[model samples]
Target chain A: MYNKQYLNFLSGLILLFLSHSLMANVITIEITGTPFNPIKIAVVPFQWQGQNLPPAEIASIITSDLYRSGRFNPIKETELTSKPVKGSEIVFADWEKLDVDYVVVGQLNQRNSKYEIRFELFDVFRGEQLSGYNIPSRTKQLRNNAHVISDIIYEKITGQKGDFATQVAYVTAIKKQKQLQYSLHIADSDGYNAQQIVISDEPLLSPAWSPDASKIAYVSYEDHRPLVYIQETATGKKKKVISFFKGINGAPAWSPDGKKLALTLSQGDNPDIYIIDLANNSRTRLTKSFAIDTEPAWSPDGRFIIFTSDRGGKPQLYRVPSIGGRIQRLTFDGEYNARASYSPNGQNIVMVRGEGGKFQIAVLDLGTGFLRILTPGNLDESPSFSPNGNMIIYATENQGKGILAAVSLDGSVHQRLKLQQGSVREPVWAPYGRSR
Target chain B: MNQIKLLSTGLCVLVLSGCGLFGEKVEETDITEETTQTQQQTTPSQETTQPTGQQVQPQTNNVTTNNNGNTGQQSNNAVTQGLGNRPNTQLNEIKEPITPPTERTIYFDFDKSLVRSDMQNILAKHALYLSENPRATIVLEGHADERGTREYNLALGERRARAVKQVLILQGAYADQIEMVSYGEEKPVSLSHDDESWALNRRVEFVYQGQ
Candidate 1:
């Protein structure tokens, strides 16, 4: 029934990748570090059935999403042998001849004032439809629907949950009229559809998303002092949770349950980790050391909290029970290690490892304690693992400008999300936890 | 005979404390201005006779924690006991003219928080002014360069601020007279990313609130 409705509105499909050049202000992605062999796939452009152009290019978005993941090599449009709108029409022998292991085809139909996107994924060798979906969409949500389909196709093939539909919140700073304008921007993981959720003249740091992805917990120095606040993503409503301690009040991280925020606060002497209960704003001190202890991150199970501390003569990663218990040092291989957060599986941790003054992102395996350096850096920091634990997004200096970048867990693929203007830093990848 | 005896006593003091500059001799209690870090070399115990609260060691230790009077001394007990917001009492009076130090920003080496020897005299001058005026208050705004992670730099900034606060208190400034805040790498006076700018950014500024 849906295909018959689509056949009437069907407009001839145009070549992929060349139909539309995005708006001027969009972030440009520069990908590097492709492994020797990645799974090759082709995403055929979806045929649209409407008087005008379809609201989005579903197949193009999915193709790029997979390409950016560093696990797949998407076939370019110029090399494609066909643009089939249905999985049944794709010639398996032709795709196999092109060395395309997997092929995706889809169609869009506008009916009764709403659009429906239907797509199918096929394995060329098996010559069968692996996954198919018919998703209803609104006009403005076309981009999101595309990402949703990307996530679906991604998980079906890779056996890992797709975080492509997740959002990334980061702090952007630009000097306007000699005054620094700092804005907190939340954008799609692909650096598309970015919206500024909060703006202030003072610097903003450490944007953490609530487990449910409804609110953003961040540190802002708007009143000339750092304070922790959780702002709703939908509405701009904000609630200040942390008190104005005499010293440092910063680095807010939410617990897995979203009921508490693991914060680094310096009341007077030095910075230490404290968990602030959201219900009553009651805080529980987790670590007590005269040395600096900040950047607290909770395990996936919320059983223990790991933080960066200099208690052992030099800075390193340390962990303590969530409710407070014996503290154990986690990293021993580096002279300086700080700003650590656990992976989704809670097996490996990523951190900014400093050697002398040069800092780089590194992942430490909990079982092996083996530290693997991920990026070449004079300064690469603020790493957050994708919900699937496959990629790490962080902020680094690109051409002397602060920008956001991502790397696969094994350091196979690298992508820099370069902004058109201004400098961006302190990007935190939000957890989708979506079963979709 | 008294003159010769004083001269011999001064020489004996100098011999006992090698190269002791008069004010530096007050290592135990860094009394105020009258004792010009003149190295105790300036004059023999001239300012010692003057009585003050924190200085003039023979006086009362009761005012030791005048900062204890308010600002929730409970906060001093636990790191988060003062979670409930409490406003700090601001001393509004302009401070006495002891000629504050020209060098206001004390710069630190990368990630190092120790107060350098050269900055001691400058810290002493500010401490002297604060000690003389009981109502005077200053905010030590700590900062770090954009080199490391923001949270770690936040801790580093606080470390620098605390180190300066300790030194000032040792130099006779009241704890209540100094309020410390670390901005970390957030507010940089120099936007440029380089060695010189980072050096300028990693500093603690003495913002005299009552000035």
Candidate 2:
């Protein structure tokens, strides 16, 4: 009887431990509208006169790039009879039978001492050429050229710009353990050729690109505390801009002119908005509130700034003059709203708002008091508007992992980047001609 | 012997009488101060009776200590304990025992911090709790939400933790405390985001670390 009792107690202990472990690893998913299926695409292998290439196969590169956009389903080589030849006598019916929406065909040719390539995008359903371009290349420029072509086709079909040619600056976990091995990564937007921009055993966050795209500013924990540093993108040389504040002194937003930055500081009792003049190294306080005042965003005109403040009994969007003066409330519909950005046209403010037990991206027309919701889910954050304000990119949780997603301004078209390993987040769409 | 016993008894009576007459008022005053202390704890609650600011009363220390592990509201009987049976007044004051408002902002790393899967449920709870308390205000304190320098990290933390606050608000947290502040590198839990500690450090904490 004693042995049986002991055995029962041991089993109970094991069950308790198992349940605890299971509960600790609970996976929470916050998926909004149905994830858009990739548009069926076939990027047949490019016929090249060269042997094995040092870089990845071009077709796979294009395929994965399209796949990561969460907008293309590439047909495997085994699933097709023959590949399309670039600039050759074409047949659209062969691709149409494969149920492909768009087909990308490319040919690599060697001339003189240099390499050149031509590619074309075809709308199989309409049976017409969608877009095509040729790149007169240098030996080292093949990958970049491929990305540019991908961007062109992506933009043509979606009627929205493509980020394929852009770079993603993110923090990646270094090891399997829980130490602070944070490596700042700059990779092709599709998560390839991931090169470490900055590697430190310190925590880093909030990477902001200079308007010139030549340098980046981010927060780092190198000195055992939060410190902001700026580094040149091309050369990794860094200069510390601010450090050693008594309280919170972070959250930096570079002005469009790249001359000044707006951020939050808590040197006093509570956090408030402040701007720093880069040329003079002087700082000015923009807001003084007893409640939390942070998350500053500049309007395109640079006339005003929007930020999250709890002064109105809750966190809501408040606009203050960029030069610093009075304040006005912009959003009042929801009890909670923060992280607001001005649309490129300066007509609407995009922000995150909570209502009906769900959080969604909301657009508030600055001229009118109209508020419209864009995405619905348990969690959707970091709503960054495209330079044109036609689309919004954000980070959201799906299937227990973080994924970068984009939605059209009209809230109709949607897409997600399918990262194979870790999660992706904090997407800032580059202005036109800035990405390449 | 009888006379000595009587004299000794008289001396004791005189000392005892002097003590009562001289010390009684001071003791009474001490009793009155305790009563006032108790009243201060109870009356302010009545004046500010909002649910979020529900009066904790004088006996909160006892209840807090007992319920620290439980994280649940204690019985009303515990509320009547005044100052007895519990120690540590400062602990109760430090803790944000009240349920936070909707849209609490958790913070994150500087350039590379990733949200460990551990924080999603805490955020979900905050979202659900915020949705339940509609009028309750919240500010998602997104420090780097402090990692980078004061300016850019401010933008980055604002973008990062504000992203978390945005998520909570989207999940149903009131846009209130759901507000975000990027301390950038101004505030850090651990001074690193290297392997384990830095990863822990490079995150937006769901702080009721409210001022």
Tens digits of per-residue lDDT for model 2, A197-220: 887776566677676666778767
Clash count, candidate 1: 8
Those runs of model 1 whose alpha carbons end farther than 4 Å from true positions after fitting are: A1-24, A48-55, A108-114, A433-436, B1-99
The lDDT values for all models are 0.82, 0.63
Identify the runs in model 2 with alpha carbons over 4 angstroms from their true place: A1-45, A52-83, A92-104, A109-116, A121-131, A136-141, A154-162, A173-178, A355-377, A386-391, A398-403, A406-427, A430-436, B1-211
Per-residue error for B41 in candidate 2, Å, reads 69
**DockQ for all candidate structures vs. native:** 0.48, 0.05
In terms of lDDT, the poorest run of 10 residues in model 2 chain B is: B25-34
Cα deviation of A431, candidate 2, in Å: 4.3
How high is the lDDT of residue B3 in model 1? 100
Give all TM-scores, in the order shown.
0.79, 0.56
Estimate, for each residue in B1-211, the C-alpha lDDT of model 1 and write its tens digit: 9999999999897765542233222233422223122222322432233343222122222122213222222345443212122222222222244656678998998888998887788888888888887688899988999987898888888889889999999989999989888888988899877899999999999998846
